[model samples]
Target: MRKISYNQYQFKVLLYDVPKKIFILLFLFIFTLILLYINLEKSEQIAKKHERLKVSESTLFIDNILDMKKDDIPKNSIFFLDTTRMKSPNKVRDLTLRQACSIESAAVTNENVKVFIVLVSPYKTLDQVKYTPAMEAILSYKNVHVNSMNLLQFSADALYDNFVANGNLLKSRFVKQHTSDFVRMLILIKYGGTYIDTDMIVRKKLKDLPSNFICRDHGFLNAAIIRLQNNLGKKVGKLFIDDLIRNFNGSEWGWNGPLMLTRVLTDLCQTSNVNEMINCNGFHVLNEDICYPINGLEWNQLFNEQHASKVLQSVEHSYFVHFWNKLSQHEKIACNSSAAYAQLARKFCPKTFSLCHEYF
Candidate 1:
């Protein structure tokens, strides 16, 4: 073979090397394009999911409003307030399993009495709301109606309109609690029906209870469960609202809630005895056994497996069970736990309970 010149050798190396480099660069370019395409696809999917969620939420909001408008508030209406604001569709709403249990229990026990869940969001519109699995399950009940209420608007029309105007709600340390206290009274005044706390699990029909009544807890009368029949012009609810506004204290927690009820009832009934106060001053003061079978101090008994049976037995004659959510919110109730609350939910709110894969 003839010896190749350095120039020829260099030219030969360049010819092969150039093609290899070009091929490698082309491969990298293709890979980068593929990666970019994949990222774009993923981004599109996420964006579409968000958009669909928005549309679904909007439809649900509109449907809730329309449903409320179409369904007239009946004489035997029981109202529950979803006072917590939902941050996003991704964020779990207030309609948790426990809260839904209350709605479900009320709806099931009082089939004739329309159960109205007033979704109250002062800042955000209903279009921004999202329902959890628990809410959906309870909504399936024929007696249950999910509705929207603007806090400001409702307060404006309430007897204690000045309470909202004075910015007392904003000044309260416990805004949600204070707002709920005010809103429930407003609901009773306007609708002239029962206003039950979202934490209560009703085992009996509230429609059968006295037209104007409030349940007792240990020492104080709780606003957890209240009923008022609308009398022409002067409603019993007006009394509660007026008293609530008159004695409204923003600093103390229960000052605007159970304490407020106790104060009002004490003045109206003219006695501290809850039993004697029954049918006193045109309203009944229900015994603790009726709604608060398990007191807040004994709230753990409902969650403790050892006390479940005893707790259940105790509440046999009770109308409903108040789990004292504020005290037990951090306490987990396993789906298969033999606790009283779990058992109650399993029986009364089966659909909501079933949705809990592990714990509620």
Candidate 2:
């Protein structure tokens, strides 16, 4: 046999063995690309499905709003607006126990008055939205009606009807606060009914209050509770709405809210004194204690076990109890605690109180 050189032997091995190794490597690379392509395709499909589901939910919500009839909502209704924008069923936009307490107390005290909880979300329907135990408790009342309304649609006419369309409200640093201030005024102008803030707990029947009135809070008229009625051919609600729109300023926080009410009442009554405003025909200004028994400076007293009795006793003669939620929202009131808020919730909004497992 002829002996081969080392170089020729290596050349033969490279030609024979390298082809098999390269073929295997090429096959693996192609397989990995195929697997990656399949996974990417599945991910795209799932994303499309999720998008479609969201569209379906939003469409249903819009349909529900369109189905609502004007007659379904009573003229003497009490309106509470929920301005949260809900995104999904898993992310339910239900009321907190404290907020539900406000509604429950109102429904319990004003059994004869229709209570309308207007949801200002355009993407979630009442039927599709999940209800918390607190929300269900309030909804058990026959007078309570949970309805959906598109904020943009409802504000369309109001925005175009006045000089407020200048986008001052949209430019505010506190957009939600300003929007709420404007919406409450628009609701009063359009419906002529009572508008109560979600932070208030009703202590007495609001239906029996003056036809058109607002409560005073620390020298300024508060819009927290407003009962406006068109009577004696005087469109007092409209006048306020017009004035608010004409003098719209989004720079200051409460300028469009409590402060605006003060200015408007002064203009309407042609006097700066609260007593004179109360004497104004077809309009009244209630005393501060009637609604805000505890000032914002002492709002924590409502949640103090030691001061519970004192706080309760002070508000005994009051028609409403404004807890200054803005100042006390982060302060938790323990369930069944001796805090004044707990006691009041237990007595006035028992259902909401009972549903709370821990701190409210």
Candidate 3:
């Protein structure tokens, strides 16, 4: 190479350094953009994300407790619920109303009995759960406790395999219904409490009924409203767990729910007929009028204005009115309306009716 002047050599070095300088600047710029994007993403979703809240008598967490033994539950516990599966706006509204109605009914009928509503995952605040209105309404009551229990807690450790297997099948299909079906039994078994579906309008204090009992609906044993006693309740609950692990039929709807209850009770009692509440082994079976006065197929009767008077009469005599969320979640029970559901909502769950008027 030809020898160059000092000025030219200096210029050449500067040229090389200029690109390096530019590359460093460019890299920093891109990194800054990335960080900005990430923060923005989190900020935008914070509204929908779970927030940490205090744990109290009325608000608690069953988080990370894999082996929730039966004794872990309280003796005075008589109510349990689930609303972790529903996600849609309409469904959320229904849950809010359902929860409101449930809390109101419990407060009115059985102020002494505590009602616990379980959430799917952990969250700090009800606002982060996407059903803030309903959650707040439920929490507003003195007897209602809103809590979060990890799905794994229900069947973690050695039972992990069975829990994940059955849960996976349910998650892909009926996330809300089947999961509710499976977990409700576990909750009842663990706590020996009454499991009431959110869709139903509670008609009376749950403790007024037998301590250990299940109801019949449409000539089939229904798990919608069930009260599990201590020893026998634990036995039936164990059977439910075993059936779910060994013979869980995710393909057939209600296999883990009503149908499973019918099969287990029949075998446990060694009885052929489970259509009516039979005083089997230790638990009693109640007639359909106890929890499901209206069959699932004719759930519309509650929302039909013409059936308003009749539905009112029937629900008055029933323990709870099952609205069948699958069929009636989208149906509006407008406030100050003539619909049977509206009438019931106003009379039983006034806050829920107000929310329906405000949100729906």
Candidate 4:
């Protein structure tokens, strides 16, 4: 007030600018922090989802679960199908009727062979009314089993029961339907038998099948269709099953253990200390079309060898077709009408042809 000057006016202006500058900088810092927080949350969620989808627990020796020593190698195998799996899922995705028929046809070809049909689910419907006629008319082979397992095991397992009983597991797990296969595979490794699935329809009878050639057509030795013939010790199979039981308690992939089994079987089928009868590097048949199933028409991959040449084809003259033809009621009826399918269809449902015409 005594000496108001130009310098004093300049100082006042500078003071005024400081608060405004501070406010702007503070606002920017807060906005940037908020953006960073959102990005971090989004990144964390993606990481968690990826972890859940694809993680292999097989190689990792889980604590307190059955542990296998390096010496516990070498084993034999068999082929069996657990048909009971078909009913477990709300949507029976991969194990279609056609797939089941193929397996039946394949197993039936060997009259003297012992085939185990593994099924895991509540013994709800025998499906005998639907499949019995088909089985009786076309297949008369013996040594074939209708191995059905109790669905209660999933619930009875103490840990898995709660989720499985509530249908929570059913919603997320597509391979629960194939639970029988896993069990059978373990049985084969432990007990020395074959494990196959119902989705498979055998075109070739494995009578006097070469002990250790990788299978063809159904690409990869689909555990769904296996040939475990080596006379390995009982402990071998137990080791495999233990893996299943442990994995089952830990995560969902036990319901769908492809990569895991692939690693295990490949190793077992390879350098193992099993009896000398065990073929070194046994066959791991990998036919890309193996995934095609019955309903599938055209195959995408070209083979250097056609099935006709390698004794590699399925359902030869002696056995029935696993007609993996997943068709609608209309399609099934139409299929039954064809002259070729007519004989096959009528053989089972004596009146199949008439039924097809009725639909018309």
Candidate models: Cα lDDT each: 0.75, 0.74, 0.66, 0.40
Candidate 2 deviant stretches above 4 angstroms: 1-67, 86-92, 122-128, 157-166, 232-234
Candidate 1 local lDDT, 20-136, one digit each (tens): 999999999999999999999998777433222334642344223322433377656888887665222233244677888889998888888788887766644465446557657
- RMSD (CA, Å), each prediction: 12.9, 14.4, 12.1, 22.2
Task: Write down the TM-score for model 2.
Answer: 0.76
Q: Give the TM-score comparing model 1 with the true structure, all chains together.
A: 0.78
Among all windows of 10 consecutive residues in model 4, the one with the lowest summed lDDT is 58-67
Model 3: CA > 4 A from native = 1-73, 78-80, 83-94, 122-131, 157-161, 165-172, 358-360
Q: Report the Cα lDDT for residue 49, model 1.
A: 31
Clashes of each: 0, 0, 5, 44
Off by over 4 Å in 1: 1-54, 57-59, 62-71, 86-94, 232-234, 273-276
What TM-score would every model get versus the actual structure?
0.78, 0.76, 0.72, 0.45
Expressed as tens digits, the lDDT of each residue in 24-50 for candidate 3 is 999999999999999989875662223
